[model samples]
Target: MRNKSRKIYSMLFLLLFLWGVLWEAESVYAANWGSVELTAEEAVLMDADTGAVLFEKNAEEKGYPASITKVLTALVVLEHTSPDEQVSFSHDAVYNVDRGSSNAQIEAGDVLTVNDCLHALLLKSANEAANALAEHVAGSREAFAEMMNEKAKELGCTGSHFQNPSGLFSEEQYTTAKDMGLIAIAAFHNEEFMKIEKDLRYTLSGLQRLPEGNILYMEHKMMLPESRFYDSRVVAGKTGYTRDSGNTLLTLAKEGDRRLVTVVLKDKSPYHYSDTSAMLNLGFQETEKQSLEDAEGFLEKIRAELVEKGTLTEETKLHFSSKVMLTLPKGETQEGISYLLLEEEAEKKEISAAEAKASDSGMPDAKDSALPHIVFLLDGRKVGEANLYREQNIRVMLSEASPKTKAAFFAVTISGFTIMIAIAVFLFGGGALYGAKNFADERKRRKKWKDRRKKRLEEMKISEEEFRILLEKRKKEKKN
Candidate 1:
């Protein structure tokens, strides 16, 4: 009877231990999203500020971008051309798209400004508007495609190529989900593009070419407030689909000041939205926004380096530029973050259209290029960066001339006086010019007198007190 009771008690203890282990495992699994299923063939979620990869699935695999290509189209157009510039549609642009496809209902003779065309290009997914803007800005579709590829390289996209302004399916055109995320990040930072991307409706300047009010409407229905997939946090987005590519979506959302860009490629009808939503929710829950402002720790680090190097005074207050922000996993310390000073002026995570254009053309402004930049790297990758500036009380002493400079000035003055006196005596004497011999002797005597005066002035250097006393005496004499 005693052995039987002991066996039963041991069995119960073993069961309880196993259950505890299983529960702990489940919690960790949930944190890692091991059970979160995704239907997209390729997708990526990235933090806009830190460029941290929160989650991704086959994100680097190349796939068709479809109409998402227009984001790049609008980006390039906004950079190279002004909003008021006019674009005229040619017969080729009007009829070149795949038959039974999307368009802004433009005819061969239709004309619109660059701004209006952008509204049509992005909001209406107007293939015709894309072609017309491309030709107007770069003079041909091939040239515009090259510009797109060049811009893609500048954004650090490795798996992408462009064949046309509009993402009409082509055998040569391809992009990865991660690459689209990069492109979306660039577009999200653009002020003009963001303004156009969020508008549910717009009245184009080409009112005659548009509907009753010359208005263009968005076709991304999911962005509508009443839609089932509508997310209030979504600031801007674009959607695309083709028979071969299936569905593609790109969106930028923010819970607060922390922004995230999510992209999904080769997905079904509702999965694109679901995948994007899942990634966004998980990202917000897992990551924390860390601002690198004038924290005492950071300031101290900067000051220590400056102090140890014996270059800057301890009083030189240090501050980071307000433009940079960091993203990290929740409850994590900044122990892993490291920094290095950059020799060249680094580009900002966000830049204006003019600055983007200027940078692309290899001509950043002089003032921007001169600031000292500190790039923060995490896990050997640049996670955040900003300019480091020193604020100090500049004690500007009145510039005092050195003894050598004073001596030089005094000698020049004495020489000039001697020459002027000789010239005045000769000119005002009312007599003929003296013989060359006599004039030469006079010059020698004047030169000797000037030299003696210079030597005496050099030997009789006065202290600051003596100089002040003499100056006061001169003022009194002048007053009397």
Candidate 2:
């Protein structure tokens, strides 16, 4: 009984050790930002290209967006109407928002272009502008809200829901930092949307009928240089404030060639630009680390391939041998040499001829002998083939190209052409030779046309009197 008890305790201790190791591993790789100095309830930093999370503080926690909700509102409006289309403000637009909501000073019956309204909505964070844009798009705010929810689903924002054009704080109206990051990414891609978010100041045209008839002007709340940490990297951002979502900010910044999106919600202070700045700094640092790791991984893959090919000894020691200077995208995978064996003997010439046939047949022979045949398979289907040494080179080439190239060369060449032409010519001819032949043929045809045109111009160069006398002499000779 005592021995059994000892075994149980030993097993328990082993499990605890494994658990500790797993915990440490997760802490190293996990996105969770623990105990940050910022007072935000939820925040996130994500890569604009792959939407991979670089850092997070309660990123999944639900919160409000306030005027940032207008990002989606603008998306819906842009989808329904062109920028130059005019939309008149109705009483519904003026009063549909919460009683104390921020206004663009848009009075009922006011006329403004959709583009101007979007500028007010995005740059000014004007609740009235959101309402006017929504009503114009779908004939009412209720229908526009439906469209917003649908778009959110399409964008894979599962943690968000919309109940109003302007975020007026309802239990039903809530979004997480992760969801908001996605919305910001989608909004940033639109040219006009980026323009509004980045603008520091905007001036509205004077109302035609108002007695005061003064131009309305507003400045970005988060653009104050002295407010907190200033980053020229932050090209565009949206600031939102309410009793529920205190001092929220969504910012877009570019560093070198990469773009980053950050979101912070429900901060303790009314102005949380400092928190935003801190988050942006953290994001840039994390992104740099990830980029470095990616470059190292690519170099290591090349080194491994070299080792496999016997070019470098596996145990060879060299400082900085695994250093790479290129940036590879996230989730990038390197190609590795794969081998196959044929069940029956086949000639090398037959194997070469079988390239097209093997692809169509979907079964390839893999042989392990002198001049061994190698077939390329993607997702278990044979794509192409080569001899042993050539195959190894192809594998290395594919690995290097995969980081920078997508859709394969054949797909790209065939995409722009008509289906019949692409299939008959590009697919049959394969790579460079087919392209060269077509180019040369076109040049020859053009040259022929040029020569014909030159000859016609030379014939027409005769004087009008000389041409008439020659024509009369030819006619008299024919009569005789």
Q: Give the best candidate by lDDT.
A: 1
Error of 2 at 158 (Å): 0.8
Candidate 1 achieves a global lDDT of 0.78
For every model shown, what is its TM-score relative to the native structure?
0.63, 0.56
The digit string of per-residue lDDT tens for model 1 on 65-103 reads 999999999999999988888788899988989998878
Clash list (residue pairs), candidate 2: 340-366, 341-366, 342-366
Which residues of candidate 1, in runs, are more than 4 Å off? 1-36, 203-215, 292-324, 338-383, 386-480
Q: What is the lDDT of every predicted structure here?
A: 0.78, 0.66
